[model samples]
Target: MSLFKKTLIKKNYKYKLLDDGISKEDISKAKNVLNSKQITMASQTRKFEETFAKKMGVKHALMVNSGSSANLLAIFAAGNPLRKNKLKKGDEVIIPVLCWSTSLWPLVQFGLKPVFIDIDPNTLNVNEDDLIKKINSRTKCIFLVNVHGNSCDLFKIRKIAKKKKIILIEDNCESLGSKLKNKHLGTFGDFGTFSFFYSHQITSGEGGMIVCNNDNDYEILFALRSHGWLGGTRFYPRRLKSYNYYAKKYPSLDPRYIFVNSGFNLRPTDIQAAIGLNQFKRLNKLILNRKQNRKLIIETLKKDRRWENQFQFIEPSKNINPSWMGLPIIIAKKYKKQKMKFLSYLDAKGIETRPIISGAFTNQPATKLYNLNPTKRKFNSAQSVQELGFLIGLHQNKISKDNLNLIKDSFLNIEKI
Candidate 1:
């Protein structure tokens, strides 16, 4: 066994937000790419994009350096000059308050306005009724964050977006491999984004992908992912239908280097692609392991003699087959004030924890800095979640008895803390 594996085993009782998600095979694949020495966004990235598209039932997938980049690309592509229906400055985008910063930043960065809505703390997703009610003529888009592996009824949202001709972007970064009615969570919107960041469903250290069905959208994204070059990298050529037309239009310029759109250099390296693809192939196993581990942790805690409904766990939404990112727990209202103390206790016990997606993003100081909420509209449910909820690692492996005992003993000490 490797020294790393031996050390990890020796410290198995100490819990973290993530275990070593990268495996030996994943490392070997990356090493092979390094040996090739052509480690830019090349063949491996293209292969991973193709495989991800096919398996996720999408028409196209473009890889980027990170999930934040994926979201940025999706937003910019939606508003690109090449598209017929493009978003413009001041257009409203409805998003849940319980979202990561990137999910909101992309919209703001693209000169669009974000309309924050409340989330259903039970499901840890947007309140579908609230979202539907907020959609007005000024609302041009809906950016949904499938938080921590749970999603709202995407079918209903899709139907509404179609009727309104509004763009939809799904941030499935935290919920990859999850499904609603047998369809993947990220496949329901006009543009879906996924992350392969550490502790996500799969990891490549830092990588992400964006998907779309329209050929035009894909072309726009393809160009935007690079420096808006018509011809992609030498190893992976983008033969857009407009290539010939652009070549003829710009006779003086090199056809292979035609600049066609506003863009960013968000391409993922071949090393990231290699490692991400290796982990992608085993995504189902990883999802299953997380599911089982979550079950074991919760069951172990609930069956203990100290169990007294001191905490509540979020469950999968209706018709949703979740791919859990972590084990999210909400302290009972009676013990709400003790949440931080309990978390510190867990930390001292060698168990790591984090808030549930930055605890109602509007409360973040950055949001105040940007004056995102001038009206001071309160999201009571979201605030409740922020006060009561926190999460711990749900590893991509079975839970050991020692670890389970540690979690149970530490978590049940909420009252004492």
Candidate 2:
């Protein structure tokens, strides 16, 4: 290739999406924190927490080290002895099969049975019909996956959870900045979690937050976050009574050091908080750019002469204004078995791709080893999604004409491959 072609390819190649859209302002905030040297989880963390809670419209937000930890906290907090109506061992939690491993594992790690739910082919989220049918007396909660920044009719899901008295946990890891009917995705559930991992809606390198509406739940989560300590509120009379009767006797020992509940050390650094807050300020811009890039890619391919119903774009469901993180392409049935060749071709062409959130997770080797698939639940849509669906980055920067053409040409090569 000539030097000109090399430069063009370098400029036109679809790069990995920016997980952290850090403007000059975000870096300045981090530099200020670094210069101050109060660098663990302090002032910036608190500010980020307040701003996040207010933005998400939740009563409280607890920043954690990672989204996976946020999930673990949410699951374990539900089962905490301090919680009045806690999820007991053997109770069932409904989760979509087309989900990330962490979302499903947390329920099982907490000793709650995970009832697998299939996703809608069109939406790539939990099917409402399947969800309603699966709700039984033993059902204690439903852990929903707002897949790749898109969600189902969360209002309907919330109504069902309320009617059944089941806990609603929104695994909003991929769907940050997304809104359903004008409400944020995470705020509808009893507990909603967000991730700041690289390539997600926003990145802090590795960080997460959990949101809830109840004061008691907030207190439990705060205690659960760091060695179960009630440092901030132990001076209160009520918490003292619940602790050892000797809390008063140990007054000189700093009532602030009071241990109140089960806990873990899942706190983000001040630096991550600074960066995350900066990205949060510009979240709308990131969401809009990614959405536009996604449209351009789709339009480029669909307009090509080689376009022949080769793939289907997973459409957002009703009332879902998506903040897409990546573009998921579902190959048509005739080309389903040719998935490997097509993806391999794309990969060879330097177009990065990945499976759609580890697809039909029940089909995983570990699940089979545990004999979790014997009941033979029909997950045809999830199965099809597994076989056909693959994703590529929807970058923050605008897709140029040449890059868009490259994507279109590569995608249309489905015929030749």
Candidate 3:
């Protein structure tokens, strides 16, 4: 190597967990949106929503401010008066222990009790067997989470949800662009949500989308996404004379200020929509790079001379073709107690990492307040993952050989560390 190149590499080598897929074009689009002065939720947002719905083969797509908001809107829409399979308060929803805080909290916020299920250590998702065991007379919903790029057996879960007449909402923030049996990950549920968070599959900086197959559900979601005003909904701009449809039939009151149902303003800005659309056009390419980087990292580690059976990588569950958001790996059981130190060591060596989706939601203090871990039956799989698991970033661009070797050398030192 040239002296100049060697110096540059020595001074500038750093590895982050992940980065957003942004380019000059995404920035240009955002600038155009700002210049148009329609920076609020308007045409751009609607265009992106339509494009997203078509890509996912869903009947309706509603753009939201964030993934958390998307989940919130979906849960609220499930209880809306206009929705056919509505959820009532105290209805039970099954959720996995290995979950993000917002995914499980949405159920509680919507007045549904969450029945905790354990994740399969091999898949890092809710186990199908455990999920079936948790179901009973009160299981009105299944709020499933598709972890990172991997997923649970969504088809079976969907069939079960259908046969039991239960609502299905997928927290698909991490698994966007993924598919099962030719169907997109989020499309199987009544509502599937996607996040455009900083390091997610694709990014608009911060935004989300909700997709559903029912027009009525879309109408309800549209109403709930705004201020309960059916402003842009089909039921809105009522031609009738009265606010209430039934009252309008009787010609009794003004229809201009009608309040159709409950709602919240979770709309995204046109700027975000413009950027998201730009990034989304290249989603297939981004998925490929992430997959390549993951394979490279594993191969590099295993090929190192100091390598031992120090870690285990989890694959996407059966039938899932994942568009992974990151590389999740678990340390061997014997090294479990040293996980905290090991992660710190990696971080100090310039490789950033994160927990495996806030590990065992039941272990969080928020769940503890409700005594959510009833029966006290130990979640062995969840605990095993918690003590052993962590994730690293997978970039949209191919990783450098030097970066790969650095990670290999650092990880190979796991035993000594």
> What is candidate 2's TM-score against the reference?
0.90
Q: lDDT of each model, Cα atoms only?
A: 0.90, 0.82, 0.83
Local distance difference test, candidate 3 = 0.83
Candidate 2: 10-residue stretch with minimal lDDT: 232-241
Against the true structure, candidate 3 reaches a TM-score of 0.91
Q: Which segments of candidate 2 are over 4 A away from where they belong?
A: 1-14, 17-21, 232-253, 369-371, 374-378
Q: How close is candidate 1 to the true structure, as a TM-score?
A: 0.96
Between prediction 2 and prediction 3, which has the larger lDDT?
Answer: 3
lDDT of 2 at 414: 86
- After superposition of all CA atoms, the RMSD between model 3 and the true structure is 5.6
**Sorted on TM-score, highest at the top, how do the candidates line up?**
1, 3, 2
Candidate 1 residues lying further than 4 Å off, grouped into runs, are 1-13
Clash totals for all models, in order?
0, 0, 1
Q: Candidate 3, after superposition: displacement of residue 260 in Å? A: 1.2
lDDT ranking, best first: 1, 3, 2
**What lDDT tens digits, residue by residue, belong to model 2 across residues 189-248?**
889999988778788878999999988788788878878877633221224233454377
Model 1 residue 411 CA deviation in Å:
0.7
* Candidate 3 per-residue lDDT over residues 166-209, each given as its tens digit: 89899999999999877899888899999999889998889999
